[model samples]
Target chain A: MKRTVPLVITFIVGLVLIAAMFIPHWPFTGLDSKFSIFYDVIAVFAFILGGGNLLKVHLSRIQNRRRDWKYSIVTVSGFFLMLGAGLLKIGVPGGWTGDYQADGSLLKYLYDATFQPLQATMFSLLAFFVASASYRAFRAKTKEATILLLAAFVILLRPTPLGYYLTFWLPKPLQFLHIPNLSTWIMSVPNMAGQRAIMIGIALGIVSASLRLILGIERSYLGTEGKD
Target chain B: MAEEEKLTIIERLGAVDRRYVFLLIAIAVIIPLVLHYATSIPTSEIVQSLFDKIESLPGGSRILISFDYGPSTVPENQPMANAVTRHALEKSHRIYLMALWPTGSRQSQQLIDEIIKVEFPDKVYGVDWIHLGYKAGNQGLINTLLSDFKGMYTTDMSGKPIDSFPMMKDIRTLRDFDLIIGLGSGFPGTKEWIQFAGDPGDIPVGGGTTAVMAPLLYPYYPKQMVGFMGGLQGAAEYEYALVKKYPKYAKRSRIASTTMGPQVTAHLVIVAFIILGNITYLLERRRKRKYR
Candidate 1:
């Protein structure tokens, strides 16, 4: 009965939200927004679940003296410190009445000195990873590989003054063969087509997933996997 | 010598070192970036289409600009956001900035301060446009706003009620906005805007996304999305269109187009490496077959 009740609620809410999209009546149109507020209320409670899970996992790790348990210490410490800073508004001169980062707030100091640099450093790692991934994946062995290789070449060549220098002598009519022009075509036509196809697939996937959840076909997220 | 001679092109292709490809891509990206600041690449059609959408909107039209990205995508997304905001301001469109992501509120604040406040000093806060601030619950927030915007968002980021603002008084739902411009890097971005807001409400929407995500949105162009700007290239294109219309903005900002030089060069380098790797693979395959 417990499982069935929630399933019924899901089915009813999901269909209503879907119907709200097409129907423009008083209650129907407002249903999406009302559901949104309802979700927010649920999410607020869910945060407690997440927090409890985090505390449990880390506490267990520390108690067991697990390998790399020290990292958990750092994680827990940072989490609590930030939590306190946010909750108490430490060093915020206006006693929580003013902006959280008024003048000497800990948040401002942490954000500027520690968080900003850490975030930037993490983002910078993408450059190296992109290089590494491209090196490993961009081998040309087949027809598709060859095409990708050539397209990549044009795209790279077209963006620089050097590309112009390299292909400068081509006749005006053959200027379409210019690297920049060719690269534009590749991105707009082939790249756009591929992206659109993937997007459509993803859209359909989301719909299927949402429907499954709504219909109670997927209940793993509800924490009673076999009951459904 | 006979065995070596018998090795085919396909066989030799297999033995290419990956490091060389990495080095080439690095060079490709770096060189173009260095050159981009010195010169500019021509804009593309997709970007022009995005520009036209904003341009065509009547003056004083309400535009809902949702910043649905974070710091990770700021480099790619920030430029597009800035360009779109600038275009709207130039057209005298009232900008209603909101965010689905938490950090997105800060991003929107930066835009308000950096672009609107700094550049268009005459633009008022509540009357012209306002920041609706970040609300959690991702698409759920969007879903609620679709029906009763005032119900969920009673006030602007500041504490004033939506009813207090003259512009917002008439605005009841998502359908009221003339255009919805979503700057998205991932989930709950352009896709969410299209599904929850655009598809259902029959509101015209557009988006700016990272290049990797751009292709996925093409099918929705001129339909769900009025137009889209993809990565740095799209930003550059939009910048180009903006510059053509309002030349002064060209001097002020060229974030997207400026970055295109590196993007193009990097793509080319990857292509070359692929070819080199293929050649080596073919040669290596041929050599192995002869030996067997």
Candidate 2:
């Protein structure tokens, strides 16, 4: 009964949403918008559940003294710090009438001074890792590897002065062979074609997978379908 | 001499600690950046198309600028957002800013603070621009906003009702906007904008995206998307175009140009390492063949 009830709900909702897209008459005219609002409202509420789970998991870890429990303390402390800052409107100028994210708020300070830099620094670490990984990957071991190596070499130089400086003197008629021009072509043509194929494949996969879910053939999302 | 008694350059290259590579990259990137090095970028056709579109837009035309990225991609997306916003402001277009990602709203606010308020202090808030903050439905938000903007955004970023903003008076749906500039990085980003809002509303869309995600978006350009800026290189090209035409900005802040120094330096370092690795591999292969 538990499984059937959710399955029926899914099928009905999925079919109706699909139908609404095509019909667009009477109640269905603004049905997508209504459903979207419903989703937004639900998501906002779901945050409590999500936050609760997070607290439960982290608190349990700290209580049990799990491996790396010290990190959990930091996590819990940071979460509560930001949450308290935001919820209490602590240090917000002009009292509660103003925006929580407004200037002079502790939340704003934490976000701008701490969160933004941390995120940017985290993302910037990719440069080092990518440089290290690519050095190892771009070796000429096989025919395909040789092609990739050559392509990587050209592309690496393409966006910078090295590519332009190396090939800027090329004849106008042979401009297509220029490193920058070649790089553009490679990205726009072959890369685009490959991307389109992948997108289309992904779309089809989604449709198929969605159908499996709607028909209740793909109940794995409900947790126990795989075992069954 | 026995192979066991001596080490080849290839073996040595292979044995070099990854930290050394990381350090080399750091030096290559940082020194050039600190020195404010730059190589001028010739605007490519794709970027030129975008520049032309913005240039040709009639004054007072509304441009919906969506920042569907987060702080993680700030290195790539921020410069493009700054340049694109500046170009729109220069054209005297009304900017309707919004965000799909949660972090996008914050990024949008940062842009407005950094560029709009500082550079174009004369521009009015409600009339010249309005920030719609962010919506939570991701692609679902786009689907609704395409047909009905008010259905999604009832209030501006500042919590004022949408009707209160003079600039938002005429905008009823995403279709009302003359163009969409989706500055994004990953899923629920440029791709989602193109699929949901741009395609459905037939709005001309251009994107500023991270380098890694750029190639995936190319297939949509010229047809669905007008043009796109990918990574620091794309941002640099747009900045060059902007300054070349409006030389006043030439003396102004140069985010992408300053960063391009490190970008170019890092690329060279990586390429040199790649070449050395290849040379070592080939030499070792030859040795193994000769032994066999």
Candidate 3:
């Protein structure tokens, strides 16, 4: 009964929101906003579930003396310390009344000194990964591969002053053979076409996924079997 | 070689060493960037459309500029934001700034400080422009603002009331603004702006986004979205247009074209790697067939 009630509510709300998109009138105009507020309220409650899971996982790891138990200890300690600092407003000038990130506050200090740098470092990893991925994926072995390779070459040359120099000797009518022109053609036409195709696929995928959820065919997010 | 006794070139081509490709691509990207190569590629129709939107807006039209991206996409998105801001300010358009991302608020503040506050001190905050600061409700804040602008955001970044500002008097919803510019990177970004604000409100919206996200937005162009700038190349084109139209901004900012040098080189490197991979696959196939 507990699960059934919530599922019923979900089905009704989900349909209403979808229908609201087409309806331009009053109450319907505000329906989307109200639904968003409702989702926010539920998400706030779900944070408790997340916190409980975090505690359970780390505590069990520490108690079991699991591999990398010290890491668990650090995680648990840091979690509590941050929580306490935020809840109690530790080292915040003028106590809890002032902004948590007010200049000279401990929260701000920790964020700037520790969190900001950590975030930046994680983001920087993308550059290395892009290089690695590009190296492996960009290979040519067939007619299609050769075409892709050549297109890539033209695109690459088009972006540099060197491209202009290389194609400078070409006649006025043959200027279209320049690397820059070739690159622009590849991106605007071929790239745009590929992007549109992928977008359509993604859109269809999203529609299928959303429909599955609305019809109660996808229950995995509820921590249960896929089938309801 | 007999068909049953030997592998074909196509099969061999499929089995190339990936490392060789990677190495080749690295060379392709590095050489151009190191050499400081520059090219003057003619602008595309899409980029020109975006330029026209800014150009057509009457001088001093009120525009809302939302910086909805963070440092992660600063490389791709910042140039567009700067160029658009410069274009608007140059046209004498009044700007109302806001951000959905927490970090974006600070980013917006930085732009105001660096560009408007410093360069154009005569541009007053309340009358000429205002920063509504960051709101945490994501699209919900946008949804609310559709009906009640003051309900969600009562004050500006400096604690000034919306009512106190003369510019915001008739601004009951997003429709009041002449144009809505969203510089976005990911979720709760340009897409969300289109869904929540532009489509329903019927407001004309245009903006720039990271290359990765640009593909997803192409379907909405010239329809829900007036125009869009994609990646570093798009930014360079916009920068090119701005400098040619108003040379004053040419000195103030050159973030887009400067970054294009690296971007172009990187693209070339990727192409080279692909070619090397193909050649290696073909050669290995030939060698294997001979032995068999």
Top-lDDT candidate index: 2
- Give all TM-scores, in the order shown: 0.86, 0.96, 0.81
- In terms of docking quality, model 3 is acceptable
The pairs that clash in candidate 2 are none
lDDT of 3 by residue, B129-195 (tens): 8888787667776776775677667777756678899888878877788888888888788888888
How should the candidates be ordered by DockQ, best one leading?
2, 1, 3
Task: Enumerate clash totals for all models, in the order shown.
Answer: 33, 0, 6
| CA lDDT of each prediction against the hidden true structure | 0.77, 0.85, 0.74
Candidate 2 Cα deviation (angstroms), residue B65? 0.8
- RMSD of every candidate to native, in Å, equals 3.8, 2.0, 5.2
Q: Write the per-residue lDDT of candidate 3 for residues A98-165, one digit (tens) a residue.
A: 55555566665666676556666687556555755555566555789668767767755665666778
Q: Write the per-residue lDDT of candidate 2 for residues B23-83, one digit (tens) a residue.
A: 9988998899778897667788888889889999999888889989888898789999899
Which scores greater on DockQ, model 1 or model 2? 2
A51 in model 3: Cα distance from truth in Å?
Answer: 6.1
The Cα error of candidate 2 at residue B20, in Å, is: 0.5
Error of 1 at B40 (Å): 2.1
DockQ of 2: 0.69
For A81-149, candidate 2 gives per-residue lDDT tens digits of 999999998988877766778888999999988888998899889888888887676677789887767
The residue ranges of model 2 lying beyond 4 angstroms of the native Cα positions read: A225-228, B1-6
